[model samples]
Target: MRVTLPASGTEVDVKSLSRTNAKRLGEINSKIAVKLAAAKADGVTEEERKSAAEELKALLDEKEAMIAALYPDLDFEALPNRDVLALIAMTVDYSLNVPEAEIKNWIRSGNGEQTQAA
Candidate 1:
């Protein structure tokens, strides 16, 4: 799958992960979710929050490694975060065979219709 970076407009070629790599990706995602939940739980201490942040950063690094393996030409670390996020979203959308209209609808759902004050 080919996707254009949102900020730089650079095109990237992404490959679907093999079953083993996909499993690794799923594990990384699960770890991230657990860390996020810990960080957000009520009565969390500052130290615990910091620990969660570090864990989340490590998980993000793992995810970047997976993405780099799939898209060797992409300098994933150097790209702006916005572009990286856009690239990830596009890659997942393509991998899942999501329609463009569905993506547009999802984006629209975030903001709904805007109205002007009378």
Candidate 2:
């Protein structure tokens, strides 16, 4: 399964997905692959790049909220920024049914900050 790490543009494929969800996971992977590839190849405009990062954060937040709602026992508000990013990446990786460890590693290595091009 291929999981897109929002913090980084790299798409990683890992062998871990339930047979039932594998197809859906492939669709998601393709979508992310296209978006990242377009941005990489065409060179995302400054504004578009900012928008992408914001969109990623918003998506992560939405997923986090959903998880919190479904699992009331889990505390989602108390984690540090890095941990929160890691958690979000992990959740996304899981939702896509990919390898959580690879996603976590990618998130851990990400800068998570926008740097303007000079």
Each candidate's root-mean-square deviation in Å?
A: 6.6, 12.2
- Model 2, 1-118: lDDT tens digits are 3444343344434233344444644555565566566556675798886766666556445545654443354455654555445544565567665554555455543433323435
TM-score of each: 0.71, 0.39
Scored by lDDT, the top model is 1
Query: Over 4 Å off in model 1, which ranges?
Result: 97-118
Task: Please tell me which predicted candidate would have the highest TM-score against the true structure.
Answer: 1
Q: Compared with the true structure, what per-residue lDDT tens digits does model 1 show for residues 21-115? A: 66777889899998999899999999999989998999888777766667777787788888777666655554556765554343332322323
What lDDT would each prediction earn against the true structure? 0.68, 0.51
Model 2 accuracy (lDDT, Cα): 0.51
What pairs collide in candidate 2? none
